[model samples]
Target: MSKDYRSFFGLSGPAFNKQIPAEAIYRYPHLEELHYYLAAAVADGAVAVVTGPVGAGKSTALRAFLTNLDPLRYVVIYVGYTSSDRALFREVAHGLGLSPSYLKGDLLNQLHGAIEHAWLGKQRSTLLVVDDAHLLADSLLTELRQMLNFQMDSATPLGLLLVGQPTLAARLKESQHEALSQRTLIRYTLAGLSRSETSEYGRAHMLAVDGDPDVFTAEAVDLAFQQAKGIPREIGNLCVYALIRAAWQEVRSVDRKVMGEVIQAQKGP
Candidate 1:
C-alpha cells in the first residue's frame, strides 16, 4: 500500500491520479475548446504556442493531447529542453530513432529524410512538440525559422508546437526573434482554475484515487483551493497535506479545520 498521498498520487504533485493517469486526460471548463484549438492548429500546419504559470498544466495539457491522437495517424515527437540547434537536432534525431553518427555530413539531409519517412510511410501527420520553449537559445530559435524550410513539396505542412511557461510569450515578443515569433500561428495561455473548477479538480483526483469524493468537504476544498490559488500543483499539495493530517486524526474525510491545520503547519516557521 502507498504510504502517503505523495505515493498514492504521483510525486511531482498533481501531474495525474492513479487511474488513467497515463491516458489522454481532460479537465473541465473550456478544456474542450482548448483541445479544439490545438487540433486545429496542428491540422492547419501551424505551430501552436502554449504558455502558463509554473503550475498551470501546460506540460500536462500537451501530453494529454498527444496521447489522444492515434500514433499511426500522428507521428508525434516530444522534445523538452534548451535553445541549442545541435541539441534540437539531437533530440529530433533521437525521437526519429536516427543514429547520431549521421551528423558527420549533410545531417540536415538525414533529418529531412527521417521526417519524410515518418510522414509518408505511415501516411500520418507528423507533429513536433517542444516543451520549455522559453529557454530556446536565440540560435536555436533562428534554427526553427530555417527548419520551417523543410516541408515536403506537398500541401500538408509540418506541425510544430512550443509549450512553456508564461515567460515564453514575453521571450517571443522580444525584437530579435520576431521572425521566429511571427511563425507561431496559434497561441494559448492556460488560465488557472476557477472556484468551481477547483472543487471539481479536487473531487476528480479523489475519485481517481478510488477514494470517496466526499472525503473532502466543500469548505475544506474551498480553503485548500484558496491556499492553492487555483494552481493544479498547489491544489494537489494542499490536498495531500490535508490527507496526511486527516490520517493522523484517524479520520476518513478531511474537514475545513483539518485542512486549515495542515496549511498552517506548512507555513509555520
Candidate 2:
C-alpha cells in the first residue's frame, strides 16, 4: 500500500451502525415539517415530498431522521432510485424481502398485503422513502401517487416520502399532475447552511473524525463556506481534502495555503 493510503484510512470516521455526531443528530428547522410529515406517514400514512438543491444535505438529513425511528415499530423501505414504476415496485418489494421474481403488479399487491399483515398483527407501520426521486418517470410517480389509495377512509395506510432535487418539485407542479401535487400533505426544501451554522458544521465534522477543529482558522472556514456555498457534503469533501493535503506536507494544522490548493484541485483544468 502507498504511504498516502496508509495515512488516509487511519482515522476512525463513523461507519454504519456507528455513532452519530451531535451536529449531525440535530435536524435543521426547515426540514422539521418534513420530520412531522414522516412521523404522520408512519402513523396515519401521508404522502410527503422533500426537495432541495444539490449538496444541500437532503439525503443525509433523511437518513438521520429515518435512523431515529424504532426498528421494531417501523418497517422502513429506503429506495435510493426508481427509474420506472416497475423498477420502483421491484425495489420496494425487494427491500421488504419479498420474493424477487414476482410480477410487478403482484409485487405491489404483495407489498400492500405485507404491510397490512404487519399493521394488523403487530401494529408495525411501513414507511416508503424514495431518495433521488427525480430520476423516476412520470408514470412511475403516478403509480406511487395512486398507492395512497391503499388507505382507509379514516387515514392513509401507505406512507410515502419522496426525497429529491428541486426539479422534482417542478415536475409535481406541471399542469398534467394536479392530483399528485394536491395529495402532498407536507412539502419541504432543504436550504444551505447559514453562516454560523456552516462554521459550526465544519468544526463538528472535524471533531467527528478526531481532527482538530482549531486546524481551520475561522477565516479558512469562512472562505470554505463562501466557496462551497454552505453545502454540507461539499464542506466535508473540502475539509477532508484540505486536511489530507496539510497532513501530506506534515503540517499539524490547515492554513490558508492548504485550503487554496485543495480548492484549486477541486476546480482543476
Candidate 3:
C-alpha cells in the first residue's frame, strides 16, 4: 500500500497547497517594487495599474498589499472580472455596503457619495481594486476615468487600482482610453521567477509547511524549475505531483527520474 505523502516525507503539513497566505507569498524584486509603488499610490489616492501574464504573481502581489493595509484607516473594495459597466458600478456600491442601482449615472453618484462619506466625513481612505480589467470593455474603461474625475479632479479621494494581463496595458494605451491613461499614476508589469528564484521558492514553501528543505533533490528541483518556466503556480503543481510520485514508490526524496515521469504524465499523449 502507498503511504500518505505528508507522512512519507515527514512533513508537518502539505507543502504546496493551492492557497498561500498573502503575507507568506514569495516576493521577488519586481513584486517588492510593486509593493512600494502601491503603498505610495494608496497614500496619494492615485490610480495604479499592474499587468502580467498568467501565474506571474500579479494577483498575489495585490493581495499582499491589501493584507498590509490598515483596516481601521482604509476601506478596500475589490472587484474581479468586471463584465459590464453596470456590473462594475454594482460591485463598487455593494462593496461599500450600499444598495446598487442599474442606472450608470445613479451608480456613479452613489459611489461618489460613498467615497466622500468614507474620506472627508470619516477621515478614512477608500481603495478600489479591479482584477481582470482586460476583460472590461473600452466604454467601461472610460467609466473608470469618469470616476476619478469626481470632486472636479481637484483632490483624489478614491484610490483606483487596476490589475490584469499584459493585454490590459495595451488596451489602456489605445486612444479611446487616453484620458484614463494620463490619470494613471503608476504602472507595473510582473514577471515570473528566475531559475534560482524558482528553486528558492520550492524551499520556502517546504519550510513554510515544516517539511525538510532537501525533500527534493537538486536534479529534481532543476527539472521542476525548467518545466514550470519559472511560474510559481506551475512550480507548485509540479513539485506536489513529484512528491506524490516519490511517496507512491516509498521513497524519501524526489530525483530527476521521478521528475521526468511527472513531467511526462503532465504532457499526456
Candidate 4:
C-alpha cells in the first residue's frame, strides 16, 4: 500500500497545495504592499504594473488581493493568456458573460459599452488584469493603450493592471511605448521572502494543514532557505519533496541530513 503522508504526519489535509484557502496564505510584506497598490490603482481608475521573478508569488498575491475586493463596487476581468488584441478583447468579453463578436470593431464597441454600463449604469468600476503581459506584441500593447482613451482622456471608467516578469517592466520603458508608460500610475516589483520569513512561511503552511510544524527541523528550514533562496514557491516545493522522502524512509522528522539528501537527489547524477 502507498504510504499516506498526510496520515503519517498527522496532517488534516494536504500541505503546499496551491488551492489552499486565501485566508491561510502567509501575508508577506510584499503581498501587503501589492494589495495596497492594486487597491489604489483600481480606486483611481489608473494603470498599474506588477513584475517579479518566476515562482516569486506574484500571482498568489494578486489572487489574494482580488479575493478581498468588494464585488458590489468593482468588477474584475482577468485574462492570463493572449497573443493579440482580438484574443485579448475576446477574453474580456467572455469574462463579462457576453458573446464575442467576430468583427474587430464590433468587439471593441461591445467591450466599451460593457465598461461604460458597468461604471455609469451599475455604479461599478471595471478592473482589467492581464497576466504574462511580457509576451504582448507591440501592436497589442498599442491597442491596450488606445483602450484607455475615454471621455477625451479626462474620465477613466476602467483600470488596467499588467502583471508579468521583470522583462515586462523593461518592455514598457522603450520609447515606442512611452505613451503607455506615462499612463502607469503605480508600479511595484515583488521580491522573495527573507530567511526569517521563509521559516515563518514553512511553519505557516504546516499549521495551515494542521500538521506539526516541528516535522521540519530548524536546521532543515535554514538549509531550505539557503537552497530555495527564500522564494515561497520553491521553499514549499522543497519542503513537500523532503516530507515525501522522509515518509519513504519511515522517518518522523526531516533534519539537515534528510534535506541534504533530497537536495542532492533533485540535482540528479
Candidate 5:
C-alpha cells in the first residue's frame, strides 16, 4: 500500500489530492470572477475558450462550474482528452447516451441531432466541454466549427467550451481557423496565483486535512512561492516534500532551512 501521509501527519485524509471536492478547492477572487464569465457563456449558448499554462487550475475551475450547474436544466458533457475528430464525436455521443457510428459524418449527424433534441424538444441546455483541445488536428477544428453552425444566426443550440494550454489561442488564430475564431463569444486566460493567494491556498489545504495552518513558517511559505512561481501544482509538490522532510527530522514546523533542503533534494544528485 502507498504511504499514508495524512496518518503520519496526524490528519484526517489526503490534503493535496487533485480530486479534492470543488467547495474545498481554494477560490481566489480572480478565479471566481472567471467562473462567472464562463457560467454566462454557458447560459447564452456561446463558444468559449479558456487558455492557460499547464497546472494553472483551468480544469479545477471547469469542475467547479459544472458542479454548481442545475442538472435538470442543463446536460453537461465533459471529454477530458480527445486526439482525433472521430474520437471527439464518439465521446459526445456517449455522453448523450447514444451509440456512436464508425463513420465520422454519421457520428456528427447523430451528435447534432441529440444536441438539438435536448435543447428544443426537452427544453434543456447542452454544454460540451472539450479539454486539451490544443491537441486536436486542424481538420477536427473545422468539424467543430461546422457543428456550432446551428442556424444562419450566431445563436447555437449547444454551448461549447474549449480548454487547453496557452498555445491553443495561437492555433485558433491561424488563417485556416479564422472562421471558428470569429465565432468565439469569450476568451479567458488563466494566470498563476498571486503571492497572497498562494499563501492562503497553502493554509487552506493544510487546514483541510487537519494540519495546523502554522505548520509552515511565513519565510518558508515565501520560499515555496518563489520556487513554485505561484503555480498550484508546484506549490502542492513543494509542500508535500516539506512535510515528509519535517517528519523525517522530527521537526514540529517547517522553516526556511527545511524548505531549502527540500528544494536542494529536488534539484538533483
Candidate 6:
C-alpha cells in the first residue's frame, strides 16, 4: 500500500479540504471586506454583487460570512445553480420549507409571500445567495430584479446576493440589465493573496492540520506563491502536491526543488 503523506508530515487531518471549518479559514483582508459588504447588504435588505476570478475564494468568503450570521435573525437561502427559472424558484421555495409550484407565476407568488412572512412576521431577514450567477440568462436576471420588487419598490423585504466570476459584474453593466444593476447597493471584487499573505495562508493550513508550518521551506513557499499566482485554491493544491512529492522522496521538509518538480509534473502534456 502507498504511504500516507499526512502520516509522513504529521498531519492530524486532511489539509486544504473544502470541509475545513469556518474558524480555521485564513481571514485575508479581502475576505473581511466581503464580510463587511455582505453585512451592509443584509442590514439594508438590498442587493450586493461579489465577483472574482476562479480560485479567488469568493465562495469560501461567502460561506464563512453566512456561518456567523444569527439564525434567529436571518433566514439564509443558498442557490448553487441557476440553470432555469423554475429550478431557481424551486431551490428558494425548498429553502423556505415550502413546496415548489409548477407554474412560474405561482412560484413567484409563493416566494414573495414566504420572504415577506419571514421579514414581517418572524422578524427574520431573508438572504438569497445565488452562486455561479454569471450563468444566469438575461430573462432569469429580470426575474431576480422582480424578486426585489416589494411594497411598490419602497421597501426591500429580501436581501439578494449575486456571486460569480468577474464577467457577472460586466454583464450587469450592460444596458439590458440596467434595472437590476441599479438596485445593487454594494459591489466588490475579490483579489488574490499577496506574496506574504500567500505564505501565511500555506502555513495557516499546515498549522490547522497539526503539521509543522515550516515543513515548507521559505524558498518552497516563495515558489508556490509565484506558481499559484497568489490564488488560495491553487496555492493549497500546490502545497498538498509538494508535500506528497517530499514524502515520496523521503525528505522531511519541502524545498524549492520539490516544489519545482511538482509544478513541472502539474504542467505535463
Q: TM-score of every model?
A: 0.88, 0.86, 0.94, 0.96, 0.94, 0.96
- Give each model's clash number: 2, 0, 0, 0, 0, 0
lDDT for residue 44 in candidate 2, whole number 0-100: 59
Scored against the true structure, residue 117 in model 4 reaches a CA lDDT of 86
In the order shown, the candidates' Cα RMSDs to the true structure are: 3.5, 3.4, 1.7, 1.4, 2.2, 1.4
- Note the Cα lDDT for every prediction shown: 0.74, 0.74, 0.86, 0.88, 0.85, 0.89
Best by lDDT: 6
TM-score computed on alpha carbons, candidate 3: 0.94
Model 6 clash count equals 0
Q: Runs in model 6 with CA error above 4 Å?
A: 152-155
Question: How big is the positional error of residue 14 in model 3, measured in Å on the Cα after superposition?
Answer: 3.7
| Per-residue lDDT over 1-269 for candidate 2, one digit per residue giving the tens place of the 0 to 100 score | 22351254344563111245534443556556667766775675667888988888787778778877898878889887856777778777787788755577677778888877777777777888988888788887888877767655554446888889999999999977788888887788888887777777766665566645577777777778888897877876787777767767877666778888888888998
lDDT of 2 at 130: 88
**Candidate 5 C-alpha lDDT tens digits along 151-244:** 4364357888999998899999999999989889889998888888888988888877788878889888888999989888998899988888
Of 2 and 5, the candidate ahead on lDDT is 5
lDDT of 2: 0.74
Name the lDDT of candidate 3: 0.86
Off by over 4 Å in 3: 152-154
Native-referenced Cα lDDT, model 1: 0.74
lDDT of 4 by residue, 48-83 (tens): 999999999888888888999899988899998678
Ranking the candidates on TM-score from highest down gives: 6, 4, 5, 3, 1, 2
What TM-score does structure 1 among the candidates reach?
0.88
